[model samples]
Target: MPYEEENIQQFSATSSSTSHSFLRSRIGLVIEARETAAAITSIADAEAAGVEQIWMTQSPPTLDTLTLFAAAATRTTHIRMGTSIVPTYPRHPLILAQQALTVSDIAPGRLRLGVGPSHRPTIEGVYGLQHTAPLAHLSEYVAVLRAALWEGRVNYHGNYFNVHATLPRTSRVPILISALREGAFRLAGEISDGAISWLCPVPYLLDKALPALRAGAEASKRSAPPLVAHVLVALSEDENAAQDAARKRIQYYTALPFYARMFADAGLPVAPDGTGLDALARSLVVYGNEATVVQQLTELLAQGLDELLVLLVPVQDASRELAQLARLIGGMQ
Candidate 1:
């Protein structure tokens, strides 16, 4: 049987259209800084600007995302913190659960723990760990995390993990999973609190990714989880210059096989000599001045995204761009 047909047969039930309390349907930013004080300062700045949440990435040679949030928790009062993704292969599920619990303790009801089995090159090549059966690994990983964080104990054995551990208390940290294709999206719907998408075109997300998520939720006899769209935003009037800057960053992903497949599946095939890159950048990035960005964002949210995670493209001054973004978000609210 074909993949889509098999999936349809397997997950034919209807999922309840449920709303999520944890997902406040607000705008957030992906914050990055090299220095601790600078990152914390950025967090405070964002909070002052009325941004609801701040997401940070975790990979080698970067500050541990959770620990940074833990530090930021002491400095800020209400701004929510999230890990865009913490790789599953490196850290054991129980360990991550414990770390997440600490963060939750510091800032109650303010942590969203996002985890995923990252790509093969980064996992195997960089971390020197095997990256086989990633979706299966992620499935088991999320199960363990949900059990440990939500239920306060985990006592089971799975193909990729074996654990029997208990936590001091049940933490309410919503575990979101990173998704690329339908398989990962379905797995996220079945197990995770939400699915976090990066670089997936808006059309593919609405047309293909979301249906798969709903199907998984339907099969599991549950309400479909939220979809957090990670998008690129540039606050600049010069569309061509901003796109040129965006292309430099996007071109790196096009070379990756997984991203290449996703782009192709979305009807934007990548050429070997990078002939079609400008179009891909234009499709993926939202540039221009404040009014244009606001319209683009409003249109995107109207398409059913539960949250917006914007990574601002550095076209002009960073601080100036952040101020403009803050103003735009404030006005929209």
Candidate 2:
């Protein structure tokens, strides 16, 4: 079948709406730990600190996100759980739906499954799998996942996926897609419940991503979904320490081709040997004392962002930084 004809309905089958923050904007934290016990403790801590949501990142070496979420579901109540992104190439859509269903059953109306075709390096270099036609693969992957989780069945046959399966049960798990560029953002608007962006500067989101998302929604004849900005923030009284931490984390992405191009497009280009990291950090990271950081974050939320998925970069102490940041964010709410 043609791709257009095969374009399934947006993943919100039974949902009338799927906005991340319906009334007011919200803030969330990214909880990452090498140990499962530590990560679960972090989730409980975020909940106790009154953090609205907690997102987990999945990599080959990291703990499986769905399993972590299931554990968190049993431990914490009233805090939302989301996957920053679960790579699609590693798991088939049906299998992912099965795992997500368990998490959703444990914590109903609180699981947001964000998925994507991760970068070429991680997908190919780490997994030794051919990283080919990522957006095409991602489009079909969301369709299949939505069919299973929302409608309880899938009969999708695309270039990258051939799935005909019936799920044990349906769920209202809001499906979100990782979007770095305009194309992916548009795809998210058309097919998924929301778009989760990483390392995209605020201006780029306003100038490029939001326009593409609106265009996609206009074409699809549906309301545009929320754009959850993945912001790397550091809460520190010592400016130098915060900038140093931001540089270390921001430099890692400079080596990646996709992120490098995005940086250039966002008007903060780096040298071939990665020399413009300071400029990138200035444009990307929100750091300073409590008052200064809160002001910057407030301005960010004012820029029409539905939610800030804060990846806090610690300057000196991780736990202390998180607790202080959580208190500030709680005050914001």
Give me the overall lDDT of model 2.
Answer: 0.81
CA lDDT, every prediction? 0.81, 0.81
Worst 10 residues of 1 by lDDT: 1-10
Off by over 4 Å in 2: 1-25
Q: What tens-digit string does per-residue lDDT give for candidate 1 at 1-333? A: 011233233222232222222222356788888788888888888877777788988888778888889889998999889998999999999999999999999999899889998888899999999999989999899888888988899996999899999999988688889998999899877887778899998999989999998888778876677787888998888888889888987898888878899889888878999988988888888988887987788767656766778898889688778767765665665
TM-score of each: 0.91, 0.91
Stretches > 4 Å off in candidate 1: 1-25
Query: What is the clash count for each candidate, in the order shown?
Result: 0, 0
- State residue 132's C-alpha deviation in candidate 1, in Å: 0.8
Q: How close is candidate 1 to the true structure, as a TM-score?
A: 0.91
